[model samples]
Target: MGVFGALNAAVSGLSAQAFALENISGNIANAATVGYKRLDTSFSDLVGGGKGAQPGQIAGTVSANSRATNGLQGDLQQSQVDTYMGINGGGYFVVQGKAGEVDGRTIFSGNDLYTRRGDFEVDKEGRLVNGAGYYLMGQPIDPVTKNVSGSVPQIITIDNSVIPAVTTDRIRYEGNLPTTPQTSNQLGGGDELLDATLTKASTGAAPDAAAAGQTVGVDAINAADEVAFLNTSIAGEAITVYNSSGTPVNVQMRWAKTFEDNGTQPDTWSLYYLSDSAATGANPKWTKVSDAQFDSSAGNGGQMLVPANDAMTITGLAVDGEVVGDMTLDFGTGALTQFSDSNGSAKISKLTQNGYPSGDLAGISISEAGRLVASYSNGRTRELHEISLVSFSGEAWLERVDGGAFEVTPESGEPIAGAQGRIVGKRLESSNTDIADEFSKLIVTQQAYSANTRIVSSGDQMLQEAINMIR
Candidate 1:
């Protein structure tokens, strides 16, 4: 019985060593696989007649079990692909498997999986698919509000359709206006000289200009008036704003010093935009958009005093019949200043508009915030989806699946949102398997397997000796 037990133990030992060898070989084989987690072998001793009344018994057999290294992280490699992503700390990307296609749409398996593999790219159907054919899941974002929509993640599908045009609704302006502008009027001679009396209609107070029948047109449409107005006003920053029909219109601006502080009246200036380039008669050419009052007092200095809110609405601003709708011109607090300039021109530090023409999808990229950002051919970018990352309480207990993905097991608790790991854009995680470590295990497994065979041979010799004695 002892010999038989010894033989059984030897056979189990061989089986255990073979199991370890298989795991070692697998690890070595996947050393180059992206996001591959190494598999380790664990051994357990099985005892046969140990606790019986007959007495103590030695260990009878060995059992092998697989251990997971899913908690371990691999080195990150820089990738030229913009969508290639890598996790830095502790988390996996939530992905879904495609079961089939129905009605020109992909049918999902409904079972969520987790993986560190992020070699994803936009497929022909505009869906983000990884190299393993898994679909990346994320929360959709509202393009207008720029806010993520829901907590639950859905399969991410990019909208490759052309984005419609956005009319200019806001223009952020920041600049320093010169106290004494070197307008063409100030620098030109004779007929080119500008007449200050032909400026915008203004009351004693700067804010009263609009209320005082601002109807008095300050547009210089005639030849003499046009030359005079151009000479009197200094050029301000100009930007191209989009209209409703996706038409690009160049909005040319100018600043003219309307009123200098005469004790009672404060220093005031009028803002104008070229309304019509081909106005032949009294039709308006340059139209006054707003008035800016400056506090030129010694105590207050030269800050914007009027339009106290620092913003003005340009109602129905149009250029050459292209209506740009209404846009708010915001000059943030302290954004506008009146200072002495050698060039006597407005120094625009920031001038941007919140509008874009119709655009087609150009490219897509992953952001540091774990959001999928899409770029457009119209020089516009929009956040499409917020990438979802999930973590588990027992990462090592996850069930291994094909393509380096892991399925949830009973031991691996339900997936939790907001993982500790962050998404690294344009990078990939290499396999955690170490060739050297696998080679060392291989050598040990081979030796152990050979020793088990020797034990079997010894057991055979003992049985043969017993049989010869019987003979």
Candidate 2:
């Protein structure tokens, strides 16, 4: 029984070393794999006595198990691909595998798995899939409110279809209006600052009818008046606005100084836009948009006077016969001033509108905030999805599966939100396996296995000698 016991212990030692060697081999094999977590061998003695060792008892046999290194993070490598991502801290990307296809559409496995691998690319069916054939999951974002629409995560699909057109609802205008504009009329030695017959100068009434109508005209019949009108007004930067059906129309603006403060009335200016490019013979060419009131006696000489009523709404504004619905011309607070310019023009530093023509999807990328953003050919970007991340209390206890992913186990706690990790875009996480450490373990395991084999041989020889003595 002692010889057999010695042989049994030797065999168990050999088995334990073999198990450690297997783990080392696997670790070395996956050293270059992305997001691979290496397993370490853990040995335990399986003694016969539970409380304490008996007198003269032999060393117990060995049992081996695997230890996980899931909590250890890998180094991040930047990639040129826009969709690739990496985690900076503790979390896993929630992903699902592809089960099959039905009618040219991919069907998911319906099983939620966790992984650190982020080498993902957009597939032909518009699904964002990793190299391991797992689909990324996220929640759709509302385009209007710019918020996640759902709480549960679903497989993310990139829609390449043309984005619908958004009509112009607001135009942000910011610049300094010239205090003394160098209009053609002013440069050409005009004795009068403004020609009241041509321009609708404010008449000091609360709602002057003439100030609200026919600010300027460019009709062919009054071709000479058109030239005079152009000479009197200073040109403003032109901007393109989109209509409901994605039709673009150019809106050219002009600013005309209507009245200077004569101690009785405040200094006023009328803004007009080209309404008809092809109008001839007694037809309206330029239409009035807004009447800007300024405080000429203020410290800065042309600070805007009205704060509460600064913005002007252009109702049913038509440019070249394209009817654009009511849109607000937002002159931001303290944004408009009457500073002197060397060129004597409205230095429009920022003049942009909130409208875009229909466009096709140009590209997609992951953002640092874990948002899947899609950019369009029309120079517009929209938030499509919010990437989902989860963490487990016992992450190392997760069951390993194919493709370096993990499944929930009895020892591993359920996945929870609010991980301590942040998403890094355009980067990939390398495997955590170290080749040098594996090689060192390989040498020790080889030596241990060899020693166990010698013990087994000695035990066999002792048994043979006992048999010979009996004979």
Candidate 3:
């Protein structure tokens, strides 16, 4: 080749090799960088006329070129992307600036932008921002307080309905009131009834319990199952005990309804005393409650609101806020529990009023189509929101921005809306560069660099030979 031609060849070789080396170094440096693509070098032949000096000969800058190849990605790939513990899809997340937050940017509605990195978290201000602090985009919802802010984080609201359990079943006390020593067990729960009243320590009055000629005796009542309780003569009826003054001081209510009316009481109800007792006028000791007390609205008897949820017995005072006795009826939840003798007779004293079973939070996972799900304590996982993925034909076409984000370029061709990539949850898609590939390209580029150096040397020798003209 002529001296000028040889020199031109050497110059082009050096330029190509330098460019290839630079690209190789860039690949190696970004080996750990996420979403980094690998680059490759290309070579071709160039020739002048004169039959092109042999078809295979190379010349000038036509020798080689370098570029990146397509990795054939962007299908529905479910990779465990961990940047955002909640992201379940491979899509570009959008963000908008809230007035002074950025240059006045917003995700969906504001100056919309695109991003691939999914590592996202909530900030102190409850902003759904990315790892680089770029805010993610979303709409507003007012669930509880019914307040909405332009820039608020998103959270799923759980629907917790509270319906309490109540006590059901009647308390039955049959036959004429007998003298003290009454022993019966004919109720759902085993409990003893106290026919006698004692003088309150605070009050020296009540005609004095022991002074009324009222003899005290130890009488007991026990719990019985539903079947055995049915067999008992005094079953299904509740009891009532008035103070020595004949005032209905305490009573064990029975019967619970199971039908719920959205936190409202049901219509139609009645109260039955399993062991109803009345003081005989023949006894001058305890004050006798006249028949008027039993039939009058304000007389000596217990009142109860029937719950439609369960047939068990509940307290009447609970419906009103005036609860009494050692037992506490939880009518708010609508659960019913009652005291009973072994023979099914309603025993007034032994009812348990409070105890409930509670349900654990499980774990977190992602869906194939990009859904963030949170497992609940009740073995339930709810779909928070569908994940969205954004893809552009050419990434380099994106304009580099401050947030490790990209500004759309005309060439990137508006993100193709799709979510067909394999999305792996709880995992991250590390940088795409392969060390072996980078090193191999580095070796090749290095050799090309050396060969270019040799061409420059050879050109210099040829120039010397032609210029010296010693021959």
RMSD of 3: 14.6
lDDT of each: 0.85, 0.83, 0.42
lDDT of 2 at 279: 69
Worst 10 residues of 3 by lDDT: 287-296
The worst-scoring run of ten residues by lDDT in candidate 2 lies at 214-223
Which of 1 and 2 is ahead in lDDT? Answer: 1
How many pairs in model 3 have backbone atoms within 3 A of each other, for residues 3 or more apart or on separate chains, i.e. clashes? 95
Q: lDDT per residue, candidate 1, 296-393, as tens digits?
A: 88988789987999998888889889988888999999899887788989999999998889999999999989999999999988899999999999
* TM-score, structure 2 vs. true: 0.88
TM-scores of the candidates are: 0.88, 0.88, 0.48
Put the candidates in lDDT order, highest first.
Answer: 1, 2, 3
Task: For residues 1-471, write the lDDT of model 2, one tens digit per residue.
Answer: 778888999999999999999899888889989899999999999874346547645567889999999999989998999999999999999999988989988888999999999999999989888888889998999989999997899999888999999999899988887877788878878722345556322221232453333232211113224566677778878999999998998988888776666665556667778888776655667777867777777564778875446688888888877988899999898788776688888888889999989999999998878999999999899899999999999999999999989999989999997589999999999999888888888999999999999999999999899999999
Ranking by TM-score: 2, 1, 3
Clashes of each: 1, 0, 95
By TM-score, how accurate is candidate 3? 0.48
Can you write out model 3's per-residue Cα lDDT over 1-471, one digit (the tens) per residue? 666677777677777778778778876886664444456677665664454447645454546565543232222223444325322334556654444534443323356666554555545443456555566653333333333334433332223332222222232222211111113421334322322232122123333232133232211112222222222223223233322222232343332111111222211112322222231222112111101001112331222233333233333322112222222222232222231124423333333322222223344455554555555553344454444456677755666565446677897778675544544555443445678877887788788778867877887887788889976
Candidate 1 lDDT trough over 10 residues, lowest sum: 200-209
Q: Residue 232 of candidate 3: its Cα lDDT? A: 25
